[model samples]
Target chain A: MSSSGITPITKSVTPIPASATVVEAARLIEAEQSTLPVVDEAGRVLGVVDSASLLKALVPRYLEQLSHTGFIRQDPAGLLRHALQAAQQPVCDVVQTLPEYLQEGASEAHAAELFLHTGVLAIPVVDADGGLVGVVRRVDLVVALATD
Target chain B: MAELLAVGVFVLAIALIATERLHRTVVALTGGAFVILIGLIEQEPAIAAVDWAVLGLLAGMMILVWGAQQTGIFTWLAVAVGRASGGRPAMLVLGLTGSTALLSAFLDNVTTVLLVVPVTLVLADTLDIDAAPLVVAEVIASNIGGAATLIGDPPNIIIGSAANLGFVDFLVHVGPPAVLGYAAAMTWLYVRHGRQLVPEKERLEALASLDPTAGLGPRRDVVIVLACTGLTILGFFVHGLFHLEPATVAMSGAALFLLVGRPDVETALEGIEWTTLFFFGGLFVMVGALEANGTLERVAEALRDVTGGNRTAEVLGIAWTAAIASGLVDNIPFTAAMVPVVRDLSAEGSDVTWWSLSLGACYGGNLTLIGASANLVAAGALNRANRPLSFVSFMKYGIPATMISMAIGSLWLLLLLAVE
Candidate 1:
């Protein structure tokens, strides 16, 4: 009910659903340095986004023109813009949700393992009902320990 | 004349390895080429003594490790350990050290350390603790742990093959001392770094927040391979039933694992450490050339003379001297070259010299930060991961741990010799 203990600067940043595209994800990430963006729908956490997943989505752009010609009605660059602009898709659709995802009620050590396993900077924290609580960034953890 | 050349090549090999500016495989390969070019070793004899068996075995194991890493199992297991320890520094240290030792005994120390380090760094970062000490503990634990089994450390592998010592032979003989050495190391860590414990509450909160699904991957046939591994270790001691080489058994197990529901070919190939394999292949040729040129024989005679032909005194002398030398030079060559010396010493009535050599070469590696390949690999890996583990800082813990373990090893060697 109260987010007072949470870093005040992180409180106002809203999490988007996993369906969001690279364009939208990048925008959200840039707007605030919220390293973790929990993907949710109707308050149920589906997946999370970090810098890694965002960078991964941008890699296929060069191939889009050749591979998706029949599928696209617009020009290549226009298609790229459209792909980047569409934000309705949930984060889970693009997010790496397997194996490294931190489950609700998991320990910090478990979270650490996920980061190591995936070579990611942050992991999404979920609650008992698979609902989004908040994100735990690597820097956040470091800051916590440094301050504690 | 040829003997001098061999010694020169050997020294160059050590220098190139110590400077770290060149890849080890390259340095060794270049040294191997030097031997061939100088005709220090003829082509026929060079190929004859070149132990492809050792290289094959190392390659097979590297592929196995690569496969395991691909599955993310080790990292996952590390996470589980971290989760269980809940960031209590002492408990975390104990868990990391114990697990690393156990795993290193079964796998190559470098591969094992490489797999575990990332997880350790993540734990350190998440816990907001400096990971240097934990990493240091891992390096020490890995060396000690690898000493427990015949197939664990590179020197042990060579010893096993050279002496025809079995896995059980290593477990019964060297294993106990390795465990004892591990205990001594733990005590040292407690006295030095135990006060740096992080809060328990923070650990619990962190534990409660992990998302497991993010890292899950397909599980391979872990059960069968583990059983085969157990059989392989069992075969080490029970040589009476059969005369199978440990490498043969390892290869057989690996083959069976592949033939019967193993991971894909690409995955299976991941287990081998090719760079290390190349390094070993090249080193064999270099050392072989020295042996051929009669340089190794001269060095052996000199060492024998220095110890006054007192076998027990010689074994202890070599053991202590190696412990000191490894802190300066790469232990792999030091140990490899000593294999023949120890063999000769044993042939001359000091049967315990081989074991002493094994103990010295393995434990002596812990004396300095750069004393062992595993230490260097761990440092490089940590640095690449943006969490650098410095040499001076590593020595802060390494020096004492090395002294304690080496002392125990020296005393143990004396006991083994006295009883004989």
Candidate 2:
């Protein structure tokens, strides 16, 4: 839909295993940019893990229902210490539904729309057979749009 | 032909909803439309079938309560109750759930659970205690408390409006049993979780150190919302004296809040539960077509024949049957379908028939995890937090507590028969 073609970054980003724990996913997310494609041993894309998904598993789930968390202390009784089991949870459990992704040969306009809707820093780009091709970084997509 | 068309569509809608295959609103609207399109009910009559009083009451309360919660009053209330529990594990759980019930008696149960469940999860998480028992307890308590007043639950609103009953009328008839039901459910919860929820010294320290008034603020806004809420409850109490419907009282309460709070009209309108309102409208039209075509009377006649015209069997049959059906389906649409049937069954002017139906539908909703809207919302919240509550786990708690509560309701109905 756009004049500029999307430059999907296939080489730079790394994918994590589907069975990785939240802490392992968190470690990978911190090492790379936010979202890392999640794949099976055969390299089929099962899902993706990003900062948001990791934090979602760590924080109290009901905070989204309230406008304010002012009523309680942050570390009320060593909150993170209590999250040991939560940290050990497989990343797939925290993955909301499945990952929304961009298909290969998609336009910059299509990539931009996916970013806007998903609010993720990077989106996994998949092929017609649903194999992980690459991830389109939001920053790179925006830069291409500016120059095109 | 007309009666068959109406009954067929209603049956299809119920099947689709229970199967959870399509959006319930879509199923209801489709059912409503099919009857009219096939000429089973005329356009004018179908439009007339929607109960404006129930819609008005739901809309008004939705706006008033959602608007009031924006000021953080509910958060402050939750923390204050936690502080009041004084670090005792049982009291802390009971205080939170007890508050959920009491607030549910006055407001919508959905709103009550939405406001309180989050803080409860957090408090539970802070202590590293399992939140399932407490969350499920709150949900069950909400349905029981919702039976106490006219505006407390959706089923009651429909029954009260159709039966021409008032706030105090429901309180007098259903309130005592609801109190007993709540106590029975709470006692069951205590026995199940009280011994298991033993808190260590550190967890006790966390409970003792909470601040109650941390979220109380934006003083002017809080005062306005609370005042509006109080005036709304007062209006419900005195609505009978004014020769006004509960719908009018609720709308007045919403309007008063709007006038004082001065929030944007567009924003305020967005807060209303338009989907639920539309779902109810569709159900009414479908049920209305059934009424117009004489299907509801036939069902009532069948019931009467089955009971051999024994008054006690008739009432208890309706009460127990409602509990079982509501658990299988949902309470809202089930109650809508039964309204016309109950109307045909009741004596020309007595409200006793309405009472049995109300208690059955509301208490019976506690029978399963998916039995009520509140249950699903709580379970969903837990899911988001990485602790998915399985259906079997919830049913383990749901069935026993509901059985006890329903028994209490049955006992009360029997006593009413004895007294008469």
Candidate 3:
């Protein structure tokens, strides 16, 4: 277990560029995983753009009409226009800067601790130079624990 | 020397609070301790100086309000009132301000505005209007509402406890002026923004979709809170009959609610505003030190000389002075410092002055954005929602509303003086 490699999943995970459009970032996030690490030109992790953040950014502002007496009608076209406009912006504008992360060689226990404390679906792993290495998914940690 | 030390500590605490450099509770508690440490007040005297009744009453009511909050009653009421307005923006503004004022009169002003402002914002958004004007009006109204009752505003609570004035006494003396001021304020609000509040048909149709009861918790919990609050208010009215302080009534209600409602005790207690309670406790000791050292008497004499024995002039002077000072600084400490001065100013049958002080300090809070805790809290909520209120923007509404309310308050005081 100590010698187990994380490279299998790391190789398969695609890192998103900081300049990528919101649509591109969203597609990458949905097809690949919940979070796609946004990397700069030098492969340094700039931020992470997740599916939830994309949805939040793209969603049009609507009045929270919580009254049961009647329905507030919203224009579908307005919502679509808002979403399309948002999708044209670079993902960097909407990305959440990484707060903390695990190192590339961090133990499964350490990875689990980061996952638990940060409450993220996955922990971004960076190399000694702080370049994006891979992400340790919660599923990956669970699998590591089960196999051990 | 001891008197100088006490005054120094008191002034420093006020400075710290005004500057917002430290948490106010910290500044107050440290000042209270410094007074004891420097021998201005001894341990026994400091303990004696602390108004346990006011502290207990504040804590007890906080607990009851917390219990009610756990049941989401405030939100339910807000949504219900918003729906009742039928999404007419002007009517919605009126309803929200009225509800905020009424709630602030009984509950904490900060809490009242905190609950109501979000709902107001949502209503504003639904109606395709900016929330700033409605929120500003609510902030002003909350302070006016709070001034009307002994338990409504912290200043009134401190003044009530100091003067041994009953809840009924405050209602009788202060309530009328507060109501008048509220009406004047609402009129100004309407005149300023009534046209802007006209609702679009689409927004009105959208507001009908809101469910007032969406977040209201269990029926039994709501019932328990309502019953406890109702009994507590009733107890406040008749506590004098049982030789009980209002604090005892509040504490008993809280205990009963906890016992019957079966809420998680830890969760229930967590909502208590301990910082505010501590701040009050410390302020009482600081004021007591001033009282002990004859400083209050000297200040009162100075004020008496200034007024030249004219009762009407004296009342108006304190009201206007307090209003301006409260607008510039936090009112709780100003009221605490002035309570002793006002007490010293009162001769036989001089109850009218107390009403003036209450009116001045409470209404003056509407003069600036930072005038009252309620205003600050509402501004904070707005800022968090990305709709920050500027000092200039707030005062545009706040200053005129304050001037108008202060004018009405002064007139009412003179009328009371005339009647007397």
Candidate 3, residue B321: lDDT: 95
Worst 10 residues of 1 chain B by lDDT: B207-216
lDDT of 3 by residue, B1-420 (tens): 777777888888888898889999999898888788877877898899898988999999999998988777887777778879996766777788888889999999998987788777666666666677888999999999999999999889888888889899898889988898899888888888877777777666657776778778889999999999999999988887888888999999999999999989999999899999999888888988988888888899999998997898899999999999899889998999998899888868768889999999999999998889888887876764446899899999999999998998898999989898
Per-residue lDDT tens digits for candidate 3, residues A1-148, read 5455454434335788889999998777767788788888998887677877787678543223222212223333334555778898998888777567667666776676766876667667788888887887888778777875
When candidate 3 is compared with the true two-chain complex, its DockQ is 0.21
Chain A alone, TM-score per model: 0.60, 0.85, 0.77
Ranking by TM-score: 2, 3, 1
State the weakest 10-residue window (summed lDDT) of model 3 chain B: B121-130
C-alpha positional error of residue B109 in candidate 3 after TM-score superposition, expressed in Å: 0.4
* Residue runs of model 3 more than 4 Å from their true location after superposition: A1-25, A38-47, A52-99
The root-mean-square deviation over C-alpha atoms between each candidate and the true structure, in angstroms, is 16.8, 2.9, 3.4
TM-score of each candidate's B chain against the true B chain? 0.93, 0.97, 0.97
True contacts recovered per prediction: 0.00, 0.55, 0.05
Ranking by DockQ: 2, 3, 1
DockQ of each: 0.02, 0.47, 0.21
Candidate 2 C-alpha lDDT tens digits along B121-191: 77776666777888889999999999999999999999999989999999989999999999888888888
